[model samples]
Target chain A: MQKIILNQTWKGMLMEVKRSSRTKTAVSVVVPFILLAVMIGYVFGPGSELISFGVVIPEISIEKVEFVDSEIIATVRNTGPIAVDIVMADINDRIYPAAIEPDKHLERFESAIVRIPFEWNEGEPYAVGLTIDDGTRFEKQVDVAAPSIQPTVEMITYFAIIGTYVGIIPVMIGLLWFPFISKLSRSKYKFFLALTVGLLLFLGISAAEEAIEISSENLSDVFNGVLLVATVAIVSFLALNFVGEKLKKRAGASKLAGPIAIALMIAIGIGLHNFGEGLAIGAAIVLGEAALGAFLIVGFALHNTTEGFAIAAPMARTKLMIGRLAAMGMIAGVPAIFGAWVGGFVYSPLAAVIFLAIGAGAIFQVIVTIMRWIQNEEGKLSNSSVLAGIAIGMIIMYITSILV
Target chain B: MLTGGQKMIIVITVVSLGFAGYLVFPAMDITAQEQPEVFVTHSGAVVQTTGDVLDPVYTIQEVEFDPEKYLREFDYGEVSQLEDGTTLREFTIIAEDDKIMEIAPGIFYNVWTFNGQVPGPTIRATEGDLVRIHFTNNGDKEHTIHFHGNHPAEMDGIFEIVGSNGGQFTYEFIAGPVGVHPYHCHVMPVEEHIGHGLYGVFIVDPKDARQQADEMVMMLNGFDTDFDGENNLYAANTIPYYYQHHPIQINTNELIRVYVVNMVGLDPINNFHLHGTLYKYYPTGTDMVPSEFTDMTTFSQSERGILEFEYEYTGRYMFHAHLTEFSEKGWSGVFYAKDNSQPNMEGYAYGS
Candidate 1:
């Protein structure tokens, strides 16, 4: 009886060991694969629920105007089943919160008005944007004019506004839900890693190209600027990662220490870069270059979409609850909103370079963390599927170029 | 892993396609042409004169060069029809003074002008008026007048085409089939020249309106001579230090017509303001003038108009270029109400 009991115990132990090994293998292979798939979906898949809108006005008028009161008013028409909220309105590089509560339902074609105070001086042009509760947005410009007491009325057609709203739907969806939906039915942590990698790779390559092509009266100076930005971004990213590894080994660091530190650093860098982009946008619209404005908007929107994922990915690593995760997702997108206002109002190319440098540094840091997280258990690193996911993400960017 | 050959092919395809797309999409930016550059006459750009009065550049007012009249007008009860590039009759303008006397030494006037006979003449035609103007550059300096609005490319009257000193060129054009038009000296910066006093008006009537109306024409231009021409000051050998200048003046309700022709070659988009009168049309050529008025109107580019108004009171009313600096310096004039008068004191003047 004693021998049989021992045999049974040994058999049970063997079964338990097998089950544990299987779980470990699954974690290593299947989890990463699923995450990779979600990253790919985010980049290439048709986005969910977000909408876009545009507004065209009499942007250039020599006729002077004297208004009793000047205010920015936006009337939103939600054509989808889901409610679209106005979270904030940005004007002249300043942001003001809108009166949109969470999860507000807006039925099709239902309109709501948002009003804000505005002071427009003659001969100085300005642009205003509305950021919806669902993360979608749109913009319009008030052209510069010489000051006069004469009253003039400018009109914006309803059809044009509606068309713009519809056009932005995909962009909104890509920004708000892609990260969350991508993690569904997979290892959320692994999925975030893949996304971080994708965004970092995209921004890094783009920045490198831009830095190389920097325009300046002195070629060497331009080259120096490019090199300096690259060096700083790369150095900071590596340095932060080294510090994070050291902290992970130390006692008493919080569970969130590594990712939190890395994310905040990256956010700082990206915020700086995005500010310059905002300035460029502002200057273009102010100068009455609508076409250039549109081009910048599209490019920045794409770049911003990737950044939204970058901020969310690190926070997600802590296995935060879903509601908390959604909040973090939005927090990451806040800089973009601020950046847009800045670009639309305070535009200077030199400022653009400085901000871009900061973003490059932050991105470098975040990407290094991502690389370390994905490294093999062995000292040597290898992840074919995640790399494949990157290729797929690039394809998505390619497809959007054609469609957009 | 994928074969090297396959990878090479994939890379080539992706790169080639991207290059193709880059080439294709930028074609959407369609506007890629060079705009004409502005040319100003350099050597004779300024006049050195010392005087108590501020020296000023010359100016032409819209009322004096009304460019917004239609080349042909429809009958009052008839609907206006649209027409383009139809050759019309020929006409001319002569620039002579009113008195026909050598009023003052070295000052000649009262000469028989071409169209109505004043500083220059008014030339009238329809939309596509292939009108030829024969001009005698009998002024102190080599001069040429280019019909500004509504003309064929060959008759653009660019400075390069303006003839050399003592030379002349015949300008031809289809009356601008659409809006008010502009005419000026295609030579050097004509602002100083016109400011020194040299210009006139040309009115192109739409074929549909009455051939002619009870019209009283006036020219609004500015000049700066050392002596006060307003008081007709006389100087023996030297030009007067500071005397009188024309502050372009006009009255309302008299069917007072204007065909402002600017000889100013430099200043673009002079603030053309009309006090107590709102222009009926604002256009490029005298082809599509709006029929009525509401308030102040603006003129842009090389444009002209035929505006009408009536003054409410009698006084030495002032009409000057609205370009504040230009007008204050000397580029303006004044008009007297037949019944309204101001005291012309010994050496004093009224109004800015």
Candidate 2:
């Protein structure tokens, strides 16, 4: 009777374990999509109101004026909602072309230390005025200052941190291809190729939205910006088609033909977008939003690791050598360092918009290429799997952005 | 004698804490103190320089009472303080027509006025000053300036009348009883006289109750546009939708003294409602002290009161007649004040 009772107790314990395991599997599948659906719902909700719509005109003012050696540098900032482009500096009625920290970009909330070169005595006082494109003028009388070197010790320390992370990290993330590639299998690799298209699709939409929002004050600007975006998308698609045809003819159906060419295109497209991102990082640092800059760096680094996995997925079937993978990584990621170096000195609003537009166009073409490939392999893999993978890819990018 | 390890630990902890505080702790922003440079305005009121624009500090003139740069106005002078040792104050009250004004959309009224406004210019005087008014009638009507105050029967404005267009008369009195009083045409059937916009306020400021503040005059009156013997619209300062379209902007935490008078013709009584605020009420300004601290106060016809208060927070606050019908029609405005102590441009929400 004692033996029978002990056996029954063991049987009850086994049944409880099986029930809990089933619950764990169910949770693992449902929770991620549920959370993501909620976020997407909020984003698309009708009542998601904008806080301000560029009603307040940009009010720019010169905060301080100083003489660094013979050059008169004025510290200027915008104190209003809209960004104003500095057109001309009328120092004591002598007009000069306006110069900014990032040469042509009129960044919002960012101050520019403008150096006005003019003949001046050490003890003399001079009047300085700035006029914007809209004919608003800011004038101030400033006394001469003792000469000193700019980019002070404190600034130098800040530049060092920016230089390392914004420049070197993307390259390091690219080189992570070898390690991540070792884990990719045949089926997982094909899914990733399709999945990458979805990721790019999200980015392309995001860039287009940003392009519209930044220049959407007047109706004319909105019309013009949308026009430019459409033009770039069509032009890039045609150019890529022509190049793919030429490459196919030269390679003569080698295993590396499609995968290598597509991977390279993805790298170039992401690199262009990353250039725009680098500009943002550099601007955030110069604008004294260091905490924002730091957060952006961490987020971008995590994002770059995904780019490594993305490039690796394409190269898996070819048994691509480690040396070639490193080279591919450099091509994809080295442009970020170059982008960072120039971001501080030369930013044009038009150029920023153009680069982003081109990026969106390039990424859109890559999606078309992947879709065409999926059409050739129709019904080989289940449709639901591909769709699920695409959804998962877009959700990851969205979650990372909101997390920061 | 401290060991090397102990010294290193102490140094590292202090440095770490200091760096963390520098990065994490927000800096407090201190509001700038107003440096009032006295520049008495040459206008309908004695205004001192109350704000600074920049280095060469000058106040921005309130748009309502910006004085005419050139002498286009017919014989107008600013309200000024009496010269030292001078015991008399003087004024000129002209009963004229101010063209035609639109009370609401497409609704026009040719209002008979005193000094080119619906309500006559507010007369401010100190106690015991010999007050004199040179009254002129520039309208095609029989009118007289019957000011509300203590005076001899012969010098009273009701008994002494100015008839026809271009009529002239002089009324004199000794300023007494420190209180706010309503002055209007005392033509028989007072309703028509006040309804046609021939009314104003005369403020006799108490000598011992002097307080330095930004001062304004708010006259509550109704307009009889249709002449059906009832008021069609009400206003705070003669103009309907004036305050709503153009808010009275004052600095946060500055004392503002508003002299409110109710001269509504049809309405028996109307109240002033200050949203999200309270005021120290001085009924009729009869005493040097206040009667109550309240947010809403009512006034009957010809009853005036003095309210003194300062806004503690920064935002746009609506002040109107508590009667929703009156507020919805016209009698409402907003007071906008900016808080200077916020370190960031955080008040405005630009959706990011």
Interface RMSD of every candidate? Answer: 29.0, 20.5
* Candidate 2 structure quality by residue, lDDT tens digits, A191-222: 67667766777777876666565435211232
Q: Write the per-residue lDDT of candidate 1 for residues A230-298, one digit (tens) a residue.
A: 654565455456555555666245776666555554455455445445545554554556687678767
Native-to-model Cα distance after best TM-score fit, residue B335 in candidate 2, in Å: 29
**C-alpha RMSD in Å of predicted model 2 compared with the true structure:** 26.2
- Badly placed stretches (over 4 Å) of model 1 are A1-195, A203-259, A266-331, A340-357, A372-383, A397-404, B1-313, B316-333, B336-341, B345-352
Top-TM-score structure, candidate number? 2
Give the alpha carbon lDDT tens digit for every residue of B145-213 in model 1.
666565566666555343333355666555545333444454455544343334445555666763233
The candidate maximizing lDDT is 2
User: Chain B of model 1: TM-score?
Assistant: 0.46
For each candidate, the alpha-carbon lDDT, in order, equals 0.43, 0.63
lDDT of 2 by residue, B58-90 (tens): 122232321111101222123345667646767
Candidate 2 whole-model C-alpha lDDT, 0 to 1: 0.63
The alpha-carbon deviation from the true structure for residue B143 of candidate 2, after best TM-score superposition, in angstroms, is 16
